[model samples]
Target: MAIIKAVNSKSSIGTAINYVSKKEKTEEKLISGIDCNPITAIDEMKATKELYDKKDGRQYSHFIQSFNPKDTLSPEKAHKIGKEFIRNNDKFKGHEILLTTHKDKKHIHNHFIINSVNYETGRKFHTTKYEYQAMKDKSNELSKDHGLTVPEKTKEKGKITSFNQNKYRVMERHFKGTARSYVIDTALAVKKAQGKSTSREDFIKEMKDQGYSTNWTDTRKHVTFINNETGKRVRLANLEKTFNDSNFTKGGLTDEFEQTLGRRERSRGTKSIDSRNKGVKRAYEELHQGTDGQGLNQPPSSLKRDSGDRRGKQKGTRANDFDIGRAKEHIRKSASENARSLGELSKPDARTRKIEQEKARELERANRRELERRIERNKSRNRENTR
Candidate 1:
């Protein structure tokens, strides 16, 4: 099996060219070039790039085609396959390419450094997702043609990110032998609770139900969890990297709470949007029709998801704060305008006081109306379910 990867080299063109074609790693016999000389590949590529005036940014593209160690393919065979793959690929036909097969490692890997500027038309070689995936497919097809068996492809793990990697790796080292690990146990419990709970308060209650005490408040920078039975206390940050998800870090839980609650703080918690919209529309119609903002008893009817679905389910939508705030502001302005249109407000006295007061009154009535509407709707559903 041969796996292809594109390398985004940060070093300058010359440095990258030297590293890939280093004499100790690969020999002149195993190296070849396309539209450029392998011995002077770097100069040829630089000259091509300089001619096109595209030397300001990227100079060349580096691609690595590595074969499986178990394949036991000879350097000559791998080099032949590498040249064939590149020549057959339409994306690199017009570009200057340097192919080197390195035998220093356990597996033989072929390196291809293609000039950025095309030799034929001076056009810069650009890579897209489609082109990259096609290269992989072509390379794999050739590998299979040579009677090599490709292993099943698996999801690639994330590369080591620059941020706090060393610090997190330190914690990961401490978490070795986690079979009876206390901190690991707490993190598992925290993730379990976060999966089910929507609000910070709900999360806290869920943790309590699991017999874990959390100092996880919005104001604090770090949360510490204490196992009730084991009496083991550990800061959330001290846990392994896998357990330390962004949702349970710092004000993450509170941020999620604020988003989930959305415009439903007055109703204690938020429900599915499908039901919320219905309640809001019903309340608006009732307020305008006859209730005069009085008989509105419908808050949004919440459809509780099955508890079984909540367990082990981590995926959820995060509410957009800007849209939610805009929606809330729209309601207040709309209520104020409606009151004014009905001639209920006097510009002299009500301009400063009564408009705000009327907006509040209408909103309160709408909320109450929704609450009552949901209760009646639930009773009806329950009666049918019993039947």
Candidate 2:
């Protein structure tokens, strides 16, 4: 699992670049590198960017891509994924990017310093929610391709803290052993309360009596419980699936417990009857048998009636009927139309293609002029040497 975050820093571009491209965190300057001009380094990149965009906004956007600690990913692999993630984004393309992997923490994470302006076009890269989501999607895709665990995708808006930050926060609060242990203790308390309560309100009251406050209001989706002692709160759904509201309703637990007891009693009774009437051919007949008298192998009459009704309805339906000839003609027409549409969409616009071609011609002509100038300079130098 990879967690990607874009932090728009208020500091200068040089400061942000120096922070991410530090040599100490990157194994004494072994793998820390940049994707900008080979001739110029971070300073020159920053200078060029400042010369182009003199806006009073964020200097650079810092992106942190962290992988799960449990994943056996080396620093090189993580850095490669981070670089690929930056390159894949259309906004980050043609811009100077410096990245380094930090091994200071338990997990391997990459810090990227992206220049706000594109060196070629001088257009600023605007960060948006769509861009963040695309980065996350690309990270997960790369993680899966590398046989790593994919994190659960959440639709919740706003900034999400990293896994380590949340863990440290919970620990800093001085909660019992861990959050999981607290959840287990709370679940046991809820179970004990369910045994004595006859209604949902009574169950909640029982829990409150045991120093746990619940937030099972109509507005809240999950049943959240707060421990009065530790002042820690956790949603019941996060503890376990069975602790959810659907399964932990009033009288629901008691009814399930009773049904389990009834099944045990029936099994014991069946064994006793079998032991006493071993000589009889239909020893199980005395039990409540179905039409086949084979115990529970056959379903009850009501279930059989429901199944028959469903089968009858399915047999009478004509939704599956179709004309093969007409269907073939329709499929051919649809296929032809889709192919034509795809071809038209795949082709570049004529006007844009013409402009790109003209730009390429201008670049070639400029390169020839520069080559001729260099040759003239060299010839003049040779004549001066002969003199």
Candidate 3:
């Protein structure tokens, strides 16, 4: 089986080009370079992109296409298949590429460093979900043509093992028996805890008590446990399917916790709104009493000073002091309106509604500033008239 994976190159294109085309891995440049010197080819590719003003942050698409270690294909044959795969694919056409095969590992894998910008069209390559599928299909086709063994396809899609899995596998294969033992022991302990604990918090606490540290949070998708002594972080989901966070929900542990958490959050939110509404009501009443003893039924405009007393008040109370009081009244009204509006939003949609609430507050602030400016102008005009 051949697996292909693409990585976006953020570092220097020349550096990646050199690393893949190194003499030690590529048999002293004999097994490297497609049409020209690999380094020169990449430099020219970059220059071509710059000439067309298509140079982007992503300089290249680095791909690793590896065959099964058990496969008996030669390095030269594997390199040819990789080159053909890139040439035949419509997604990689008209692009400068460097191909190299490494013999350092048990499996024969090809590394491809292709320019992002197409030399002919000056357009960058677009990646999609189907790209990996296309690569695998092409690889399988080429393997069949070369009389190589092709793994049978199953009705159920197999899980793709992650790089971390392979890394740990190598460590386990070598002499790191203690680390491997720690991982297995921790996974078994967590599984046992999952069966007993009714809530996620309880399970995590139990795991910590048993000498494992959990970094699982409500925001995280997966739970990770670190071995306290070894400091090795292992993803619970990666260890076994039954130990995954999704399984906890299926087994009724996380579901119960989530429902309980939701109710508590809603209760807290309701109490917060009630407290805020009371504060707003008290502030509104104070503003009404302070502003010339006006009633609550009167509009904000009615709080303006009389033309005769404006000059006297302007001397006694600074324009800023009057504006501050008016601003406070506006804030209280805005808060009350926002609180009522939020109360109508569904609990599930409260986060989205908060953005709208912020926009409304900004609009209210703009109106308040304009009203304050008008009040200040009126006071200035009254003072000049009195002069």
Candidate 4:
């Protein structure tokens, strides 16, 4: 399997590029063997580095690479897969790209170095927030072509294999009560809503309304939570505590309250598997579809996933490229008028300019509000599952 790593380090870009180019296979071998000809590896690196380091005079640098070891994968196969990936992602055409493989890891993986500059405009590339996930998803899709084992969507807890359990244990210890808090709060909210005896069915509905989520870990057999607020891994025991907390139990709430509580419960933990499962079968059904939660499916519906599916506006009314262009033009015109006119004569024009400025300001304010709303919504939705 190939693992993709994209870095925005000014100092590391060159080191990373060179390390992949010369450290593993000779620079010539990479260029000749890889199908990305006319788009040579060295030239690709140089072009990408130049644009990322020079354009807009912004010192911010970024290079993305995909790593797959050579022991498990032949350079020939890796090169083909890399070329295919680039061909499929045509929108990334203008950017410089290099495909390389290393001999260091267990599974052979390839590295893709890309300059984060938009070739058409000689401007910095606006990397999307979901770019990494998109890359992983694409990589997974490509793996099928090579007859490689395509990783299935796994719960965050399930992903903690023996190799990485210690790392997770450390995180779980440090972020104590983080993920579990949400689950506990949701359970408590459900209980309080029904006068200390909420039905499991009602609790599940409340959780769904609020967009909370729950998942089973086939490896661990734990009902893990993706806390919406903390984005931490929450085990089931923590949920029990948050529910018993005084603040949630004392108040009477509607289905909305249960929904909100449910959302909080599921959002505490974050795992890539969660995103992968967005379009898959429901978590509850996956676990309880056949047998009760006792078998492979451990935790049943008192812990329903609040799917977090409801949608709202994203990217608040912030100015677009066109709006910014107009504002710049207005400012230039206003500046010229001030330079040419007498102080008194300029008063009317200045007032008119001021009105234009206010319009721009209003648009900007609306833009900010819209962006903020989207950000909050994204944060909330992100917490809906444990990868």
Candidate 5:
């Protein structure tokens, strides 16, 4: 696993550059620079800093990328990975960077020295905790591409997945400061709550007890949640990934609730074609299975007969206004035109078609000849002008 660390160094930039770019510890070939020449990087950096008029307390920012010794990695690959680590990070976009790969130590590592003042914008480099995590995330990405070792993430506070000493690697980047990040975070917390609640009511109650106002109903299009204290509302449908194809277009909270209960009561829920035993399964089926326990897959039956045809359009709504006689007349006229067109296609004239094709070919040939003549005239005119 490649590990990355960043430190704001108060020491001299020249001293760090010399220590990193030493030929005995690492070759000049391995030492590279971004937006500047490695051999005269210090001079170039000083010029940029002076251009920005940054007479400074902090000289440069330092970063270290060290690799796991257990993995067999080459120097070139390691250097390439280190370069990518800088290039891929958006924070280092306009900064001049000095990168050197050291092979002298048992554990191969790369040193990154960056100019504090950006060349183009003259902006000083600054980093926060979030920015450091972003760098670590980038390092993990580059390391994975090269099949290098990557360190497992440490557990964060407030998340409850670290029980039983289990290593849990879930969730992903909440991109672009969008609402989807909060929705996914809510899903993780809700999933943890679901693990303890056995029934649908119990699950909703648990979420309420946890201070999340449950807005999930079987028919509601969005399984929304409201934070009681903060008064923040988020829709699970906002994530746009329901992950279920059935009728539960919302978060499928109801389905999840019932499924968990079913898994728990498998002994009493399984019927096994034994009609003699009336178990909890029957009660569950009656509750979720259709209206009046008709069957699990049966659709809800209406007490009154439907007024419309098989299309479900109400009887007096549109059927009464539709003109069947006008429709029949329209169909008859369309058939007549179609038959006339088919009859026209049956009669063919070969000589007329051949004459049209010949006329097209002759016109194309004349255009090509005229183009060639124009090219020859231009060449002759150029030769005369040159002489």
Candidate 6:
């Protein structure tokens, strides 16, 4: 929902920068009753002005606004997003970008004023119509990332086109695909309107009236039909070309062709989340059973647990003092038995004892031999040190 309007200024880059900043601050104060943090200031302007001296620091002005996505016109959000937009676009690097909020409307809308000169190159930064549209797309993207409510596609303005209901129906019925309908209708309409044989000028006028456009091909050999709103174009065959080449018709109706013929509708149109919520609740009821018009007839299971009487009765199966003492005594006796098993009282019987003693003796002998080897090594080290 964000809108972009660029202004070409005939002022110094320093003057333009200061003017834009002041305008932004004034608008922000009027709308939000607060001063903006004022991102991208005059010093940045001086740095930029230094780069493209021949461009005279400012030959053009760019006004950029990033509108609030949730409402498309929130003043606070507009101010915030607009600043971010300039901060990101490299074209605004050396130029002054003034971001402002407009408060005179029900929805928040903001504006950006930018100087067109590039500090590195004296050339102007060129922004096309598509780039402006892209700015709106980017605004929506930032809104979604911030967890703000995004307006459904249905609420957006569809691309503009000339074809209306009657024309669309005529094209749909007569043409095998979209192509035949548009080409045939256009041809037949031109033929029927001939003032006994209309002149080319008259034919072009009639086509324009019918919401068709005319543009010449590069060689000026072929005529093209266009949709004014979307700027989509389609090439039409001259009478001679149509008759001379059979394959010319084989191109069929492409998406581009249909669009030029105004056969396209915006796909973004979708119900907003708030509007869909109520319908979802109603749909849920018809699919589920055991419900009164008001609510469930029986109390839910959770309510039964909170009734109190059952819980009180369940708590009565408690252990007595005698039972507790006996349990402790049982645990102590088991621990005592485990201790004896690991000590003198639980030593193995004769044959098993003899095997363990033999194993221990062999281990001791191995240890003593290793100790004697260590002592011999130490004696050899002492003799070397004495020498």
Tens-digit per-residue lDDT, 1-387, candidate 6: 444434444566546545544553446342210111134334443434434343343354545443333453445656666666666665456444445566654555565555454433546765544664565566667666655444332121222111133443544444434344445444544343332222345546766776777664346756676756556555655421332211122121121233333422333224355458778876554333222222222256634653645646654321111344445787999999888767754456755887889999898677656644543454355345435
Residue-wise C-alpha lDDT for candidate 1, range 199-298, written one tens digit per residue: 7678888889999888876588678888889888888666523332334454445545665565456555444566888999976554443212322332
User: In model 3, what lDDT does residue 161 have?
Assistant: 25
lDDT assessment of candidate 1:
0.67
Candidate RMSDs in Å, in order, are 24.2, 22.3, 22.1, 24.9, 23.4, 29.2
Model 4 ranges with Cα > 4 A deviation: 23-27, 32-72, 155-387
Among the numbered candidates, top lDDT falls to: 1
TM-score of each: 0.42, 0.41, 0.43, 0.37, 0.42, 0.33
TM-score of 4: 0.37
Candidate 6 all-Cα RMSD: 29.2
Q: What is the lDDT of residue 82 in candidate 6?
A: 66
Q: What residue runs in model 6 are displaced by over 4 Å at the alpha carbon?
A: 1-58, 64-74, 147-387
Give the per-residue lDDT digits (tens) of candidate 4, residues 161-216. 11123433543543464544343344433344344224335544554454545444
Residue 233, candidate 3: alpha-carbon lDDT: 85
Local distance difference test, per candidate? 0.67, 0.62, 0.65, 0.47, 0.66, 0.47
Q: What is the lDDT of residue 73 in candidate 5?
A: 84
Per-residue lDDT, model 3, residue 92, is 78
Off by over 4 Å in 1: 154-387
Q: Residues 1-387, candidate 2, lDDT per residue (tens digit)?
A: 787755534677767766665666776432434444322345545554544544455566677888889999888888878777777777677666677788878999988877676655767776544555677778888888888887542222212222344433543342343344575567667767765665557768988999999887767667888999998887765543322222244223444445446667899999989877784645443333433323434347845664668746543322223445556887999999999987775677955777899999898677656644543454355345435
Q: Give per-residue lDDT, candidate 3, residue 259.
A: 53
